[model samples]
Target: MTTDEAREFARSYVRFLESMHELAGRGEGNEVVRRVQEHVGEEGRRHSVVGRGFAPFEQVNVQVALDRWSEQPERTVVVEGVTLPPHYGPVTLQQLLHGEALPPTRLTAPELVDLPSGPGRTTACVRNGLFLVDDEARGRFVLFARAPQPHQGEPVLQLELAGLPTDEAQKVLRELDELRTRHNVYRGQTVELAPEMHGGLSVVFPELPATERADVVLPDAVLARIERHAIGIADRREALRAAGRHLKRGLLLYGPPGTGKTHTTRYLVQHLAGATVLMLSGRSLQLVGAVTQLARELQPAAIVLEDVDLVAEDRGFGPGSSPVLFELLDAMDGAAADADLLFLLTTNRADLLEEALAARPGRVDVAVEIGLPDSDARRRLLDVYARGLRLEVSDATQDDAIERMAGVTASFVKELLRRAVLEALEGEAAPDGVVVKDEHLIRALDDLLDSAQGLTRALLGVRDGAAAPGGGPEPHPHTRQAYASSLSFVAEAGPGLQPWR
Candidate 1:
């Protein structure tokens, strides 16, 4: 043969040998994995894979766990090609135990995600990574944390342990779970759990209004009752628990829509400083189970489910009748007697809530009615909303406004002051020093009471048939009839006398 041909043959033979060696060396700790698995398995030849899941709300929390767990001396590599399977999607580590084959994987730098750890705070967490953790306490094991992959059918943050004894896997996972709780981002913060389109929960940090005692315009007794149950009890929880008193309490606040049910809850939330406040309303109340479980992990927690009756059926609640309602009831009942947990439920339709609550008793220890504000409440609300405003109205005008505002809501009172300011701004009162006068206040009240704003009045929780309870104010004795209703009744009545449509 020619010298060039001989050289080419030698190079080809070297390439073949290199390929064989690489194939054989591809097994990284394969035997150790086998021993760990086979020891846990029937034959003790393969690795045993165990796993646990974290709710979508806990994405940041679990990331915190993995970050701390991997802080020790170890090697981490990103599990590449999760989308290489037949379905072309991400695969969880647990799939290994279910007979799924490990795809062609290359160890690469880990993929990490930066998430909000708190209000105006952020932290980095592993997205798709595996840890070859070898330690004296836990020994050698393969740990993986997989983020939710909707297309691949993984709907939650998943953690899996491979090649460890079954009992050992469980213990380590338990410790990790505890670590998650210890570093929970939602603990002692005011937040809402919002669901993603992919069926995972995302933590929402909402700035809850800071409400002081003076801001809550309910009757003194009513406000006192709320504080005693939600705040006062928590304050004395240690003493009460020492005396063997149960700290788990449920408070139900029912009233007409916009009559301060939610406002009252916010007041309670403000008082619950340093306690985790889970505020769920509307359709979000369906997440009672997840939120409640999280609350248990975060003690000194207050679960505020606003308008809870919205999720329950108007009829009886049997098995499968109202899963959301059932979950709510179960959550409240499941709390340990000594747990510092509070359930604050509010609903406009108390009648609808009565049945579901009756189905399972003792869930609510106290129920309070936050009805329409009385004359005194109206006066106080007017002054409260007008705090930062320049008021040029006389005492007589203020009394007239408050008396005319009977049967109205705290919301209505708040809007009244705002509308009065707008009225002043529109009528010769410059923006620089706009002073709300008696005329402006009267006109704004007239517009709100006009029949054209029927839905507006209802939305503000104003009862129909605008008549004050106890006959505080009679219809004006001298006034022109309204242009619309004049022909029907040409009697004397002022703008405030417009019959609530």
Candidate 2:
């Protein structure tokens, strides 16, 4: 509790006692005063050092008091929440009421008798500088420290080592004994903990598990960029070694849909051995509080947001499409301020991002384009898929259809080949598993063409041309470009900048 709160509680309790005293002075033998005295001086006390009273509540009573308390703000109390690791000790609840910080040093056989408090509830144990008190009945209770000893300007402990001695040891020991005197570690000197102490708040932050690593594949160029960035991080770290500072590196990947942007990010997580990564999708940012909370939770880890266009939508003029995007911008700046953190974003539409956000230099240090797979990449992509299918495509003639399928989108290539393989495995299983045929390829292609046609109409704003007399297909960019180019070549012979239409 704050100093003011302590003063208030003390004032209130004194007033209560004064009222009881006045009631007792009436000389009518009031039951209320009698009960007050019963608890105060008559309060059944097991032991007392000074005027303050101490009572150990039964387990049921303590639980009842804890239950009545509101569980809001989400972080109050210390029951199931503050989990102490087993390595601390096999301490009991009775020992905690006695109030002592647990000593971490393991005791040797010779030093067993030197243990303070004679191995009872008087001595305490703490882990990671956090002290957990074992209540007589309430089990483990984390004691809030009043104020931590100031860490700043503290003396550094110096170590002096010497081998166990014969004659030489005796001489060194005698000299050391004369120079320094041994002191006793006293226990049972009570230190009270207030509820609002900073020590208690320090224990509220949950511990995170170690990150697990996995192998992921990426394009060679993307992998090369990752290596260069890794080296840059190492160089920055070396430069800041004397100052003990960390460096931040951010990369933004922009590309069309069906590209391997997400895969590339996973590859980086695998490559950076000690790095922790939290992957969030753009849709999750739409929630009012999710963005800020996520930013805070993901600090000190690489925050990878996929499909950033969902967050940075086109709101037409200057007004934002979503308030969360502004909050996200603030979060990005906050994350960047920490020298050790990095933020990586992947998006399909670069134009959708705010101009101010996209133009930031250090915010997005390396803006790489994950373009569609080239012919050679397609060849490799097919080979990767073929290995998964366990099919031996040893004959060059047999793979003409597969070769034709490359150079498009990775998603399309993987999906089409997977469907063909599924079709080939309809009947009995063969030694080589069913060999995917040209017919299966044709069927997959037909399905892909239909899907592509729909996508094209949707994206290019093509309609049924219902307004036209014949109801023909609407004019499109590809047709317009082809027709205008053909006429331009004809016109170049004579007229210029005029179309045949």
Candidate 3:
């Protein structure tokens, strides 16, 4: 037959099929539907066809496949007005079948969407309809449709290789899969497991600014250890791998509440730029395998699992143990030793973790305890958090205050300073010109040390004896002298003079 004749015949056949589909849709053509199904089944038995089903809203994936398939441009067939999976809306299906751009109307409910990368929350919308995307190699347009209800009843993706052999079609599908991976939706973004969707994760693009290493209130030694092992190891992967040491390392940060564990993790995240950061905690830990696989694929990735003891609790002790712990272990063991993956796990209850996980050499190479801030560390924390405060006092008075705050937890120091600023602000009608003074701190301490606020103060890391009416230990004679000097100096220097520590 001539090329024109063959084309006419193909068009005629498509029209006939469409008519049959329409008749069946109206409930008057059961025989036609059966026959079409039988014919499709017979063809499938005769030829090796490459096909996959994607969610109707996953237009980007379908578009990538279509772009890859459109290079040869043999024959294009489109079927429309079909019922798709219940999860898909009618508009999305119509857009996919008609090759029209997706409407701006939101498809995903507000709660279902992951955090967006932009300033405003982004609702899930199909960005484009079926379109061509160019790759270095082959190109092909795809046939995408929402299958008719009472039929297969799903969104279908098919790559038509009109006269090509089975092997050639398989090669095309493989190439398309590679392209899909290259354009992965989650690449370069943080992700968290979605328990609602089994085996799937939701994207979480944290807008957190990178924290400074010095700003983290942990001990210098502990900070140094984490910097060397977790952040530094990721930076010098090539050098370590060349020296016969593997790049994969696990560091566990264990501490009580408000002890700067998470603060340290944020510091590491800031230091390790260009690496994928996977933040998992709570029920999301079930996706350990999926997260590890992604980390392996995207090397130089960091997996920050906060409160890991929730899942890694000692398996032998009671019913609270998580079955996902085994999965976590498998994922850790399965990864290549030199893959440049960093596992940073944090937990308040380190003693509750399984010994196998904690003691294992490759599983946890370094464990750092982020204990309560010591006297000197507490002094530094006070200095760090009070950076912008206008303390109308002399250096000696500020030193006396810091010395009085010694042995307080970092959490207490932070809250104490914040409350002091608030107290200072309360005394002035205009906040623009308010300056915190020694009396403000004294009043703030008095409020916090009230007998009724004992529990609150304890939760904030105030020791039992430290919750006295005046707050902190009794000042020595020299400390009181320094405070008097500070008051005199403040009166002489004027109200806005900034206190130096």
Could you tell me the lDDT of residue 390 within candidate 3? 74
Q: Judging by TM-score, tell me the better candidate of 1 and 2.
A: 1
Evaluate residue 20 in candidate 3 and report its C-alpha lDDT on the 0 to 100 scale: 64
For residues 1-501, what per-residue lDDT tens digits would candidate 2 score against the true structure? 999999999999999988866544442243322222232232211222111111110111112222332132332433211123334543221122222342222211111111122223222221111122233332222321111111321111111111222343244334332222121111111111112232121111112222222222346656567555633464455466557654565566665556667767665554453444445564444321322333333333455667776767523223654344555555665553435555667876655553545343335555666655655665666666665564544456335544544334566556767876876676454875687765665555444434345564334233232122222344433322332232222223222112122
C-alpha RMSD of candidate 3: 14.8
Q: Model 3 — which ten-residue stretch has the worst lDDT? A: 104-113
Greater-lDDT candidate between 1 and 3: 1
Model 1 over residues 1-501: C-alpha lDDT tens digits? 999999999999999988756543443323322333333354322556788877666878987876676664543322321222355566555543333344443444666677777888887776766665665665556677777765466766788887678898898898789889998988889887665675555667888777788988988888888789889999998899999998888888876666788888888888886899988876667667778889988988999998887777532235645467777888788878788989999876666666666667677767777777888998889889999888989999898777777667789889888899999999997658889888999888887776566667666666534544233232332111221222221112222111211
Model 2 misplacement above 4 A: 1-219, 230-246, 286-300, 313-322, 336-338, 394-399, 437-443, 450-501
Query: Deviation in angstroms for 304 in model 3?
Result: 0.7
**Best candidate, TM-score-wise?**
1
By TM-score, the candidates rank as 1, 3, 2
lDDT of each: 0.71, 0.40, 0.57
lDDT of 3 by residue, 138-183 (tens): 3232222222121233223333331124675567657666675665
